[model samples]
Target: MDKKKISILNLAWILILTASLSFSGCRTDMQEASKTEEIFGTIVSVKAYGENAEEAVFAALEKAKELEKIFSLTISDSEINYVNQNAFKDAVKVSDEMFYLVCRADYFSRLSGGAFDYTIERLIDLWGIGNDWARVPKISEIEPLVGLHDYKNIVIDSQNHEIKFKTDTAMLNFGAIAKGYIADEMKSEILKHGVKSALLNLGGNVLAIGKKPDGSLWKIGIANPFNPSSNIAFVEVADCSVVTSGNYEKYFEEDGVRYHHILNPETGFPSKSGLAGTTVISPVSADCDALSTATFILGVEKSVKLIESLDGVEAIFISENGDITYTSGISKYHFKELN
Candidate 1:
């Protein structure tokens, strides 16, 4: 063939090949892979979607179970509870998971100005507030045990990944922050397994790791502190976490006074703030959980200011009578559904 004819033939074949490859690529899309699966339980649950979802959910569930063991104060065999129970007498060595949780708790202790403390495990046990739902401890009964509470004395050996409570009486409780930690861990597990889109809910604490296959943000409902059946606001978020702590979730009323969890560390009493619920949004669920619980105790003006000072935290407080307040940063994300 002539040189001109040869060049023309080569150009035609290249165009045809490009068209065929594009068509083939379209046929095998991200949608063709298996969608994820879902598993639900008391303390932890996960819902995964889009290609390989079943295996993804299964893997997520196993991770959730592992975290549940790590976070559970009820599991006497668990490292966390063991650390709490034995801290007051001798230095108790902790597993890597327990060490991570303790470090987070230590960080939050400084963050809350000591108002939010997990070392009050003795008080929690005396009051029997969480899980077993302890009744109020006699003032005398709790005051002495309070000596067992010591966060500063506790030491974490980060190099070896072991922890020791300086005193045997010292106790640690992850109740105020563990759910968020687990949510964070679960998301990490899913992401490691190539899960691009998943939603993790650990006892109402919600996290959206990525966007849906259709390119829409996940809609997460913020539960009404007063109404458990439906949420008060729906937040559209992706790659973020929203955690809510309420005065009403687990509490028994006595006479005219309402005694709920989220106790005040100073008085060993439930916070007197008129706020009933507080929700925090941040990049990590652990910080979000701690801030939400601590903000509820801090009340309106202080809570608002505290949120403002943080780099990437925003909070909302709902007054007992139904008034809604939120930081300027998150006003757009909050919706008032009280009619």
Candidate 2:
């Protein structure tokens, strides 16, 4: 065969092989996988579409479960439990991961001025709203613990990754922020396995990475505080998290009075912010989670002020009377209010 003709034939074969590989890549990019597990006191789910989707989803869930073990106070051997037990006695050395989360939680605690405090574990235990022991506590019992919710009570040594309590009564609980952190971590793990698109619902918190398989924004529903089974509105978002904290999430009625889990550290009682629920949208799940709780406690006027100062963040507040208020940034989300 002529040399030129042979070279041309080789080039043709290379082109054909390249096209075949490209087709396969496109197919795998659209493959879908999903998984769900109960963790962090809620049902968490991971859904992804891309290469290694199944393995990635599985690994992501496992990673979140591992994190839960570290954060769950109910877990006797959890790092948080250890810190609460010994932090008052001596500086408790903790993993860098735990230290980092503690730092983030502390930041929010200060930022919200105790509205989103993690040191309110004693109050949480006293109310026990989510457990069988849920009830209202006496003023004497509440008075001592409310002051402990101050973030300054927990001391952090960033250099050595150690934590200590300035007050012996202070306790640490990451329940408000850990789920969002786990969702962020799960998104990271899924990306490590080459998934380009994923959605994570860590309980009511929703996180979307990239866009839908068809390149549309993810639509997340904001729950109606008055109607827990229904949505009050919906927001379309991409590459962000939508987290909601509401009085309806956990509560019990006593003497026709409702007591919720989101206690105001200042009062040692459920926040009476006149807002039934607050939903926050941000690029980071942890931020959205913490902000939702804080803004809910801050009420509409203060929340709007706080959210406006933040970049790439938006919030929606549903008042106890079904009035809706939101930040100016929320308009960009294509928000639709349902009647």
lDDT of each: 0.76, 0.89
Clashing residue pairs, backbone N/CA/C < 3 A, model 2:
none
| Residue-level lDDT tens digits of model 2 in 207-262 | 99999989999998888898989988999988999999999888899999988888
- What local lDDT score does residue 39 receive in model 1, on the 0 to 100 scale? 25
Give the count of colliding residue pairs in each prediction. 22, 0
Error at 21, model 1, angstroms:
23
Best by TM-score: 2
Mark the regions of model 2 whose C-alpha exceeds 4 Å error after superposition. 1-29
Window of ten residues with lowest summed lDDT in model 1: 32-41
lDDT measured at residue 306 in model 1 versus the true structure, 0 to 100: 86
lDDT of 1: 0.76
Question: CA shift at 316, candidate 2, in angstroms?
Answer: 0.4
